[model samples]
Target: MRIKFLSIIASFFMVSFVITSCLDNDNEVNYSPDATIRAFELDTIGYGVNYKFTIDQVSRLIYNVDSLPVNADTIINSILIKTLTTASGIVTMKDQNDQDSIVNINDSIDLTKYVNATEKNNFLVLKVWAPNMEVQNEYKVNIRMHTMVPDSLSWGDKPIAENPAGITAQKQKLVTLGDNILLFTQNSDKVYSTTIPAGSPSDRLNYGQSWDSKNADLPEGADVTSIIRFADKLYLLTENKKIYNSNDGLTWTEDNVLTPDGATVTNLITSFSNSDGSNHKNVNGIASVIEKDNKKYFSFAEQKETGWNITTSTEVVPAEFPTNNLSADVYATESGTLNAIVVGNTQGLDSKKDTATVVWASEDGKAWIPMEIPSNNNCPKLVDPSIIHYNDAFYICGKETKDDAKGFQKFYTSPTLLVWKGVDRMFMLPGILPPVKLEGGVIQYPYSEFSFKGKEANYTMVVDRNHYIWMVGGQGIDKIWRGRVNKLGFLIQ
Candidate 1:
């Protein structure tokens, strides 16, 4: 009977122990002190995922490295921030108007008020609290946006620089040597060069550039039209089929560039620009050539350590290939095919008047092909044509063969390098328009589009490393204009 009573007492003690353990588990409390933000998620549809933000836990800062687009302000008021989770606590943002009171941020938070107060800068008063509300941590954020429509190009009232050559002469060529804009003037059958400070219109006006003439030993009658840069030296084909290279802008040296046994290079085409037209240096070029047997053909001028290694193409120059006033550029197609393109004036044998600007292309620099100009999409009869690969397309700018030389500028662009269309709005030139003048005592309205103000025959253009278009026109308007597409000139973008 005593043993039975002891057993019942032991069972009662065991049941009591189980009940005590259940109560302990039910009343458990967390005392973690760490409070942090695990991720700060931005709305993907609006921001487009490119505006990546970096979180600096040490400095307690969250900001984007790249300035947001111009439209960032569109959603600034109701910017959707999908969510901002925390490592701990009930996430809370200090009340914008009353900092003393806090608003619990459930799934999303409204930061527009805070952003406005701090001017888009994230002054993160964001706090993650421990569950007991005893410990807390704070973070700050910053936002940046572009001030203007980045892609729209704007040319401030006047030329960034004018009359850089400081010469009254009307026949010259503009070229760039690194940062310097050099103009080679035609002086008594000999060409002399002068360097001018080249910069944007945003730079100080009338840079008071000194014209340092580099005219010690320049070759006589060097066709400024035929001058092209290859490697580190500037080379020009003279009237007599002689090739001369210059180290300095002046001192000319005769480079015995070997052609085929009986072939002679007539014109130096152009050094190939990169496929994207961003770079046009240290590359090979093309040469329009003729054999001693009176055969017209083209050849390739390969880049070399010292000079060009001329490779004669087996094919003959097409009958329509331009003979003079030519501008050419070699570029790679998307599929990596090398295409050499040339545009110039072509006139019939008995016709004194020049025909429309003609275009020719070659794949291997040997076989030449003419791109047929459609009647519906015909180009102007340009006297002096210049072509360049820019903005994923080719642009051709030149003067018409019409007399007067006023309001005769023509600018055209081609995507497939086939159909040409006149450019407007974006490239319509303000610099090309004439100033309001008196017509029979009545004030005349300025025409919408025109060439640089002059009867200039010699005009040269270059797209600089920074993609600024530097144009120098000779004949009358001996001025230099530096302009760029607004976005291309942005510093921080």
Candidate 2:
């Protein structure tokens, strides 16, 4: 078919008088052949067989010369030279193996059918149609063009003649953050960080063997829940519902952070050692942690036969208390209650970890007591907490959820450094909740970490200087899930 198409175009000029005259009057017409005349003429075919090719519905804008005359083709082989360059971005012969990402726009969209012998001389258009991408401002589309003759092809990237190319090339964006914030992502088993000064380009560093997916046992469906850097260690929470620990931000050692049962062997959730740098105990499901008065405290969600439970522990196991002393004051009365907790580092009257007024203390790991405060609705039940020592107060930050059927993350702050009961009124933070949506006759809500309904989970936020928040394991209907802030960040949006 291609051969037949070129033969017709070649014959069009066979009868033209200019060709015969140029040959006979070579001595008389000594001037060089006009470039414009040759450019407009169907003369040079790039040293190949003059196969017949049919060009259908050629648009007017794609002509070789400004004033080139258009000849009607009632099944003519020659196509009007659209651009000065003969390389028609339109691909003709595609390798069946060609998987050029450009050609893989929509699953149902067949790019093979778009391949053809000729185009009106224009690059193909690509459109994205995935349901998740339909409304997103940032999306990707794949496209592929076929170039048959190797020498005639003048493309930077061209597919082989009969085989299809791989089209799974995914697109990624380079994000820039302000000076105070450093951004990074975990690609496979390695951790990569790009630090951007307030207004400058990023300085990137890649740490090998820093993070592993097997550490957290990340849920079966999604990649990972969350990762953050706290203290000095590079911690990673995996989808496998486990926590991975690292010291130098390179090599890692993982331990069972959380078991399906409530038993734990470590007292330290995350520790910023004075000598060893940042590190976390090989424990899982702890959400957030913070330090104040040189002491560290951690809060996490654990599974129980009754329902989900939230508990807190200090980094050091006191000589008096050999076991991890969990505060007994706060407990969800019924099952199916989701809770998260984190210590706040902010400075205030009630912000000291050791000297705070009302402390939820337990001398022995067996007994629990909430001293100096009473439980009331004024105290918001926290689900996931981010505790930090900011300013002079030990701030306890957490996701305060509504007590009704659905659970959500509501940012709240408390200045009281004491136990859960003595804390000050819960004040909501400004501008942080995920947007909600109504789809498929159901109200779909956005969760920063776990989704009980959709069973989808994603973790955000950086854990200290190197670690990130990592959340793992959540059944579609709110079963077992353990999440913690780790050292590694994520790239998937």
Candidate 3:
């Protein structure tokens, strides 16, 4: 009887141990945080590019939501998307007469609202909301969230709507005006002012040079390509084939600097590639003006050489400037590529056009030799390239042309201009895939557009001290677009 009693106690102890172990395992497996994603489920949607948090169970929400790291109990009291979307929190659209069609912020088709377990794994609802704005029909909208928590941000997602049909192209031109009022002269000669302060449109601003309105005007039959204001002088290249230099914005002196012998195509002297007056010498127009180490640089198309070249000025005068060969493409097309070139003034890099790929250096800015890119990659193929320097790095913007008809904006970054490989910072901006069709023939209205589809060019980038990148379009109208790299990624300013 005593042995039996002892056995019964041992069995009871084993049962208790098993039950305790099972209970502990259950508790561990069901571990929950006071602040799970379910706490204050945030869902940033589009009225514009901003975050919209959906209040969950967290009564006292906490987050440092202004692009910094988010923490607990941080309240996102308000979010203002600097957009046309109304603050009433309702989405809208336009009718045939260009009137508003009201819709709930939670019901628009282009917009989406959702909650995430974290920023990573999220659930999506079928409907969305948008605002009724004119530009809303012109651009595609994308919204994403960034969280302080690791692996809490959303991944690659498409914009709410495909860009609608319209003339989204902005007329962009480079002009030097009084008091540094850089003007983007429209094709119709209508000037769109830039950040350059407005002052008298006098020839004295450019010294004695005349901005001969008719002389440096857009090609008689083409378009106004770009203008550069370097040093005290202003240079303008017209699509109709002319290069005009002016000491002031009003008075202009015409020079066929690139023309072989200054051939008069329709009475307008086209800028020649060489002094011999070669019509086929230069194909494209002069692009951006870059100044490095007290030297002024000009980028343009060298048609005869079948590539692009960069010319530098030892003096401010266009006449005294010595031209050097930059990068030349083996092929050329209207669908041609432009590489953005930025010279490092303090970066101690060399100044060769073809060898400007960062890794290669020419201390004197002339004689260049081939060097290996660290990645052993080929050079980038740029069509209509534009460049800007910022924060010790050169950012290049150009259009990547496919063998097919598709083209889009592409970018690259390097500490030096030489040794720029295909591998660099690459980004595609929000632009139309279809090219805008323009009118041809008479240079007067040569800038005509088709009613249907057209693609836009990548932007010409200019970086300011405030780190804002000012961009102007290539073939379209002159509208200035600003850009910057922000916490939410790249924002078109």
Candidate 4:
């Protein structure tokens, strides 16, 4: 009886042990060998030309895990985020739930501390790891950052063909008349017209037929310096100080109303007219400073029933400027105000070069007052700068000497034309690298000189009615390129 009882006890103990082992096996958590990223999401945010991302905008890095088991002793060894370009510094990532804590699989990570405002075309990469696992898998996520603002300039696929053989192609000027763009050669009455291409408004310009010179009514061999449209007539200013008016580009009428007095008309601009319907005309024309008999004078012309009436103001020359050889480039702003930026060298009391640059502003284009321009370290001395009122601001494009060794072309913008700010180099036109000629007799790539003097003389830029900025024929350069200006005054793409 004692042996039977012992056998029964041993059997009962074995059954109890078997039950305990089964329970333990059933309750055991199966830790996945490989973890999976279910979803990686970034917050949608808009960007601008000069947008600086704040910490809150880029704080969230929401992600979901598929195979990570809850209540399991899964240890995340490290979480790293970096840009694909440098891959140098480890991005500072923190738990979104607890700002001071490190990032974890359960919580989203803050990514604001990692992003930079200056860097563009950037790709962000995230790498996560779980240590001491059987598989020891590393998970990764890649995201691309995009600019919310449209590019200022995007090159088109079509390339403008070279000028027909033997055609005298000098510097070209773009004059926008309604829907068509007229290209006039410097020092020639010949004009060529092009219509804006179909499709996107950002499409490249398409050249049309060249106009007959017989229809363009100007003196033979007259050098066309500047052109402007006022009211219902198109006016052309010649280097010899002659004004020609045309109802249609086909037939021009010489309006010899303004006697240039031997001073060449360098610029022509029309002021904004009063909209009260009280005035018969809404536009006023102003010519650049003209030199006559060794004295500089500002000329004004008004369209009337008979012809354009002219008036000259000798007092327009600022007292600080050299009375002789005074030259300037004039631009009319959207507000109908005229801004004259002195271009040539100014003379001191001793008749030498003056260091100060002068800028004058006028509403009526007759009475002018000097504007205060603050000195900026980034504002370089502009050489023969071209001013255009575009994108709600004034853009001055010219060359500047850097480190006194090399000179490069740059652009500056001013909201009120009183204070100017330089744009970043990344925003400038690309594909302007120095030219290289290949062995096949094909010019590899041609570049323009930073300075617009000597060999680079006649390098010019203009903005059309469509807000498309064009850099046309320069001395020894027949290449034409176009760009767009954003509302924020940034030249893009």
Q: Go through the candidates in order and give each one's C-alpha lDDT.
A: 0.59, 0.28, 0.34, 0.44
Candidate 4 lDDT over residue span 1-493, tens digit each: 0011223434554576678778896664443433323334332222212212222113323222111111111121122221111111112222333222222233333433223322432323332222212332222232222232343433332224332211344645555565566666655555666566554433333443233233345555444435555545667665455667776565777775555545555445443333212333344554445556766666676555676666778674664542322223345544544454533233444433233334555555555665555455233444444566665466666544445523334566667656766664323542343346788887664434322222233444656555667655454545555656432222222
Query: lDDT tens string, model 2, 5-104?
Result: 2234335434444676767875443322221111112232334313222222223111221111112121123333222211111111122443222221
Residue 128 lDDT, candidate 3, scale 0-100: 14
lDDT digits (tens) for residues 123-221 of candidate 3? 321111221111222112222333334212111122221111112344344433344334343445333333432333211111111122222333332
Worst 10 residues of 3 by lDDT: 202-211
lDDT of 4 at 116: 30
- How displaced is residue 407 in candidate 1, in Å? 4.3
Give the candidates in order of TM-score, highest first. Answer: 1, 4, 3, 2
Candidate 1 on 216-272: residue-level lDDT in tens?
A: 465666677777765467777777787788866677888676355666667776655
TM-score of decoy 4: 0.51
* CA lDDT, candidate 2, residue 221: 23
Looking at candidate 1, the ten consecutive residues that score lowest on lDDT are 1-10
Q: How accurate is candidate 1 locally (lDDT)?
A: 0.59
| lDDT against true structure, model 4 | 0.44
**The 10-residue segment with the lowest total lDDT in model 4:** 65-74
Give each model a TM-score. 0.70, 0.26, 0.34, 0.51
